[model samples]
Target: MSDQIKVKLPDGSVKEVSKGTTALDIAKGISPRLADAALAAKVAPLPHNGDQPEARLVDLTRPLEEDSELKLLTDRDPEALEVYRHSSAHLLAAAVLDLFPETKLGHGPSTENGFFYDFYRQTPFTPEDLEKIEKRMQELVKEDVPYAREFLPREESLERFKTEGDFMKCHFIEQFTKPDEKISIYKTGKFLDFCRGPHIPSTGKIKAFKLLNIAGAYWLGDEKNPQLQRIYGTSFFSKKDMDEYFAKLEEAKKRDHRVLGKQLDLFSIQELAGPGLIFWHPKGGIIRKEMEDWMREEYLKRGYSLVVTPHVARTDLWKISGHTGYYKQNFFTPMELDDAEYMLKPMNCPGHVLIYRDQLRSYRDLPMRLGEMGTVYRYERSGVMHGLLRVRGFTQDDAHIFCTPSQIEDEISGCIDFAISVLHTYGFNEFKVELSEWDPNDRKSFIGTDEQWNLAQGSLKKVLDARGIPYKSMPGEAAFYGPKIDVKLVDAIGRLWQLSTVQFDFTLPQRFELEYVGEDGKRHQPLMVHRALYGSIERFFGVLIEHYAGAFPVWLSPVQTVLVPIGEKHLEYANKVGDVLKAKGIRVEVDGRNEKMNAKIREHALQKVPFILVVGDKEAEATSVNVRTRGKDKTETVPLDSFVERIEKLIAEKKPTLD
Candidate 1:
């Protein structure tokens, strides 16, 4: 066997080194500065038979025993930050063990923003205990203890953990490793963990980290298992970055939809009505009306026929649609009615399909677009019910199109165009698109033949490519029934929300046996496409609240104008002005209560009213008023007619800002 192996760098440079040399040695040979900044190394062994293996992250100390491609990851790489955060989680566990020796470790993994570690103990951890753990973590960092890795026989490792009262570790070992194989472990000081790790060299590498909070989680996510305490934390490469992150978090808290919803009296979730069910208040209902009206008008303009479907149907319908087999878990409990079982609809597709199949369609009536603002219900677990973003019941602006194979591309392109329009109308300018395709190797997980899958995916790609739109292709992320295109929008705080989707379902058409008479005088199956622009009305409303920070634009504000009378004598003129605005289709409210004008103005301003008009003797006699526009510091006096015209124009044009 050769004693030397070749290491290829990302820049296409290669170097021959001893087989036992480590990645850290290679980095040091390049430069001391590079070695100091390295956090982890990604290595891929050279292909043997024209097949390339995926590159994997490993410890810098891992020995390279074969010809490989190596890339040393530093602070600049996002993947390195993930590894750094995972190592920080281990440090957290070590600190916990130092303070409370009886704590049993579960698992620690990095999340999108930070890391979390689960621990099982009889006594719950207090805030004060967290503070002590954080301080001990600092001490460990000061000591710069090395993260040592070792492996042992699987049975021996499991027996050691079982004797030490670490049942969770034993469970993990038994579940993840074979009895005859070795198990990987990591040790820091006296703290040991059964982990498959590629951690940073030592605790000192974790410079900026904070323990955020703790929550209760069931073991393995089962309600019947013992509950464990999950502690959350975050780490960053630099202090400046950490500070910026916290600042953004503070802003996000201030803009939380739940807080703003109560302050503005928009929406609520009543405990008596049960969880995940929303009750839209009077103020919120006005906004919803506007949203629905706009969407319905667009449907008519786009040549779609509006339809309504029953909220509940027989279980036999779901069984035929295959929802009973794949999506039964998410369905609410079935109800027995008249010796037959019934269930609330979790989707609107089957109902629309039934309508299309009611009559034989011809080629001349090919593209039948059915649209509905249908409300559906699903059973969401108690722990997963978020504010409006996640709920048990919601309305979907769903539409389905049945067309010929030759016309499928145009239909998809049209759906994309409509989705873009929805984003623009809702004041969102930035968006991302993802095309999820099925996996050929996983035949059992996905439906449809190769020809159908290829045709559907190719049509979606052609539409996006022809329009010069950039998208990420995600293989193996498609639904069991078909492939789909998802559109996610970036909100005001730079958070992504899933807003729209256009999916291709060849399975449903076949399952329902939908057909149309073709131009060749033969019966052929119609292609089906399902699209939802505003994924859910409740979720979209929540996004709107956060995006505008409760200060809606002039077109969408519940109260477009509020008139405040300076004195009792001016009430008549205030009402006159309000009536005039109301006649022009503006949502106007007159503050005729016995109160000071400035106080009334301040109250309405707090409600985020778009326009506050103060009418007094001087302004009333001149037929003018003082206008205080939202988000503006200065007040301007303009004639009532001119103010009405300007606001009318703003509302008519659907402007995103008052100015």
Candidate 2:
């Protein structure tokens, strides 16, 4: 055995360190300050996977067993936060065992929002119990117990968990590990858990934590197994950080789309109508019409042929498209019609395929783009629905491009450019693009031949690279058919929402045997590109609402402008001003109600109208009006003619805001 292994640092310096040397020792060798601030280390193998490292976090005291690239994490590193929070979850489990030793353990993971630990016990935890658990966690932190890692054979681990009545742990051990393999486990005080860990050094490393709430979750996320009690909690590096996190959460709750939807009287999902369905009210409908109009104009400008598809199709059509075999879970149960079983269309791809096959086309007719605001239905699991984000039925801004293999790259580039334009027009300044590729090792999870996957993925990558767009390449994230690119926009609150998707499909064309006449006088298979910029109008609208906190821009507001008359006599002048604005293609509504000017201004402000024009004796005599803008404390008086021109320009530009 070699006495030392070569360790590479970020500065391109290599040093020979003795085998089993801890990361903390390496940090100390680098600098005292580095050692003091170090929290964890990320290690990567020599060759790495792709351009980035296949890295995993490990304790600062954990030993490196092989030649590798190593990165020491400090307090300022974002990854340190994940390790800190995960250790907090371990602290929670340790504390729970101290208080209730009989509680059987399940898995605990660090979620995006926080951390949660599941426990299987006869009695459900209550509010007071959560508080007690939190207190005990604090005590454990003060005691400063070390988190020790140990390994056991998979069979031995399963038997241990089973003997302790930890059925969930036993199931996980059997599911994720082979019978003869060694499984890793972490022990903190009396509590032990099977985990793939990158935990912090000790319990004392977690400074601030709180148990938030309790909820029931099925074991292994399957209802067939007994339900387990999940204890949710959050932790931060410091008390100030924790407080800020809680404050941001409170602010987010205030701007929640569900609450704002009810307050603004925009949309609803009626209990009687059904779950996962949307009913756009008059206010919301107005906004929808505006959105549809913009999309239609863009379609014409971009040379897309708008087409409509039926709401339902025969089972035979789905069978022909292979949707019956592959996408059956998301489809609605079949309905027995007069002669055959029909189903509400779950995807627009099959319908568009039928349209393509309805006619024969020459090579000159290639690269044809078909666009629609098509509505489709899907069966979402009952617990997974979240307002408009996840729904049973929704309208998609869908389009499919049929083109020869030679034209695939340009078509994909066009879709990406179009997606970027959509984000910019909607005031989104930041976005992330992901290139999802199939995993060749996981053959059963993906379809199509290796050649087809290689070609499609290469095209997608080339398009992104040619455009100078940086994207994260995610293996095993591709759709069943082929590779895809998904675009996520970062909103004002720094939250990401998936909006646009451009997918390259290999199965649909082969299933339907779609073809176009080639210049060589032979029929050739045409490639299919499925893209949706606004995934769904409902979902996009919901995100926009939260993005702006219900204060929509001038072009998207349901009521663009409201005219408030100061007195009953001035109502005539207000109507005249509104008429002139409306003549210029602006959406203006006159507030002719018999109320005080202040009251009218406040009401319109609450409705988030972009501009409020108040006409009184002073403004009426001068042929002008007082403008009260939303979110502005003071009002400005401007000429009626000037206001019309300003609003006209805003509408013409489709500007997101008046400013």
Instruction: Give the best candidate by lDDT.
Output: 1
TM-score of 2: 0.96
Tens-digit lDDT track of model 1 for 1-659 = 89999999999999999998999999999999999999899999977799988789999999999999999999999989999999999999999999999999999999899999999999999999999999999999999988989999998998899988999999999999887888999999888999898999888888899999999989998889889999999999988889989998998898889999999999999999999999999999999999999999999999899999999999999999998888899999999999799999999999999999999999999799999999999999887898999999999999999999999999999999999999999899999999999999999889899999999999999999999999988989998888999999999988899989999999899999999999999999999999999999999999999999999888889999999988999999999999899999999999999977788888999999999999898899899999999989999999999999999999988999987
10 residues in a row with least lDDT, candidate 2? 45-54
For model 1, the stretches where C-alpha displacement exceeds 4 angstroms are: 1-22, 43-53, 63-70, 439-444, 465-470, 473-475
Task: Candidate 1: give the clashing pairs.
Answer: none
Residue 652 in model 2: lDDT: 78
lDDT of 2 by residue, 1-659 (tens): 89788888989999899989989999999899898778789998666455655778898877888888898997778888888778888888888888988999887888887899998889888898888888888888888898888888888888888898888788788788887789999999998889878888788878788888899999878889889999999988888988988887887787788888888888999999899999998888988998888887888888799999999989898898776777899989999999999999888888888889898888999888999999999999978998878899999999999999999999999899889988988889899999999999988788899999999999999998988999998989998898999999998878889989999998898999999999998998899999999989999999988988888888888889999887899889988988898888788999898777788788888888899988889998999989887888888999888888888788778787776
TM-score, candidate 1, is 0.93
Q: Model-by-model lDDT, in order?
A: 0.94, 0.88
For candidate 2, give the lDDT: 0.88
Worst 10 residues of 1 by lDDT: 593-602
